[model samples]
Target: MKKDNKCVDINVSANVGECAYSRGSTPIADEGDAVIRVPVELAVLNIRTNLAAKIKFPEPVLEIKDIKKRVQIVQCKLLLPGVAAGTDPFVEGSYHLFIKGYVRKNIQYASPCYNSGVCVNSEMRSLTTDVPFECVVEIAEDDFDRTPQLPFQNARAEFDFFRQQDLGHGYPEKDHFLSSDLSQFHQDSSQFYNQMPYCELISSRITEWDEALDRKPFHNSANWQEGTFETISEKMFLQFTVKVLQNQQVRVTAL
Candidate 1:
């Protein structure tokens, strides 16, 4: 069905905090040859958005015809320790992060409203809703022995590219990974590193509905003929943590 309005753009704002890193166990191998995966979890305080969509009222009375839903993974980030190469027990404080994902858009609409005897169409409206997110925990390297699981399996491949580039090493040039130098010795704590990190929505969803609305008009108002009504509301939130990459399986060596 043709939509009365469509979302053209979306702006995301979020609050992040509470960051901790843990090490995973390396397989049974030599110290230099074994690989370990670190897990980190950041808390997601609050997430909000601003949307850009267009709508037009062709007639005086128009009811919602349909509803739509769109959910997608927007981005991913990997957290790492502040320790440089060849550090004794690995630095305790400070951290680094690697992010990768696609740019996306979000659109929302309210339930249809009515007027005096006739349904008065709406021009445009804005609304915001609070959502709950899952905060993945940070696991230590040795902990991998019991609970062995890697997060963000869907975006792992792309994240791997960002990992390689950050390591000051070269991955597949044809893959077009983002340019970022995060080598052990040349770490840039100025950019995406955080200590008390919070969880952020890496994926978002847009829901559209034509369901009926509950609204009442004010009779003593200036414009009584044009009644006020509530619009439809739809929301989706995906949360993941940025862990310290203290023990990651390197895909490529620095050149």
Candidate 2:
């Protein structure tokens, strides 16, 4: 079959599924019950095997030509200092964000063969396993653009000093000393609960480098120049972009 080098195939048109659209912001009161969203930056910790790790290959390989790597997060928990609950008042302070998880790795390597001293790998082998990791990252208060809304407003408190009354039952207080009555004094406190903070994973990126720690001759061949590796050392650089969020009652300015 003869095909022209500059033959036209298809022409695609631009998609205009959405036309002009806009939403008018409604005027809100100075204070109201509402939920606001907050976003922040997040960092991922590095992982390294550090020592020789055993590998049980389905079939022994003469040489590891290449290794493919992947990462998976089985668990992710964020720990903070003075953590606020849904019913706990918000505390303003910079704190650490603790993250814990395991990396799920599927390693595929090229199984090599020797043909007259020329090493060639025609078959690829794979292994799937997990490696656990954990870390603590600092999150400053100004890291995120959106400010956390407070559950309660600062209101002026009104109070008055109590008058001192003569207490016959009490000591003379160093010969006629005046003291305020304590039995009738009372105190009260008002606390408001705020929304608990949480996190959402936005994106993840991982890079890996692996090497064979030890290698031995294949089947102890008399003249074989190829060998197989039973131990591998793995290292990875992982990164993640996550959003720290919390829904809280906030006052809105009419737009």
Candidate 3:
């Protein structure tokens, strides 16, 4: 090492061609811990479900121009509120996942004109509404990336005492005996907690149909005028896949 920065070069003869490869044992380090704590993937679920709804219009809608729809997922969960922790409940030999969400619908339509029957004279109106929904799907014997991990608890230990009294006259001749306590016995049962399972949404798909069942043309009006609809019915076929997850410990190893 030099304090003052300076460059020095040494002259030597070297070969420029490629060197032959050599075989040797790969180096391996001793592991300090056997397992690592991390979020692990549990199972993948492909769910298919449908929902139907009938909605009423705010005002008189003469004709429908356009409608735009989008899905907004509110929550995805694997655990229910009343279910016990660290336990998975089965219904009909299957696990159930509950999904909650809403669909944002934007309706662009023309309102009927009382004084004029012509569609061009009618006023165009826009309505935005959210249709909420909830559904449950059953999952049984599903495929997993690996064996799903179960909840773990620590080893519990308790201490007890025995009744001890020394008999000086009896102990001088022979060994003294002690008796165990028999009045009360207790073993603590609430020494550990569980890591609950969770859910992650992968993707969602929807096929929807919106129809105006009561749409009718104005009285004594030509075909150019728009029809009115006071009520609308919608059918949505939703499809999505989710991943159930939990915290797990995996062993560290090298191939």
| Best-matching candidate per TM-score | 3
Stretches off by above 4 angstroms in model 2 are: 1-59, 64-68, 80-90, 110-123, 147-194, 219-225, 251-255
lDDT of 2 by residue, 1-255 (tens): 987795554455445466887874322213735533333323332333222244566655555555544444544444443322233344455556666665666767666544444444457777777766676666566663444433443234445465655456666754553555555555554553434556666666667666666777655444476677766777766776656565543564445
Superposition TM-score, candidate 2 onto the true structure: 0.51
TM-score of each: 0.26, 0.51, 0.59
The global Cα lDDT (0 to 1) of model 2 is: 0.53
Please give the TM-score that candidate 1 achieves against the real structure: 0.26
Q: Give the best candidate by lDDT.
A: 3
lDDT of 3 by residue, 123-205 (tens): 88888988888887655644555344333444445556788656677456455558766665646554335557677778878
State the C-alpha lDDT per candidate: 0.34, 0.53, 0.66
**Decreasing TM-score order of the candidates:** 3, 2, 1
* Candidate 3 TM-score, true structure as reference: 0.59
lDDT by residue for model 1 (137-187), tens = 343454332212122211111222234333234655455446544452332
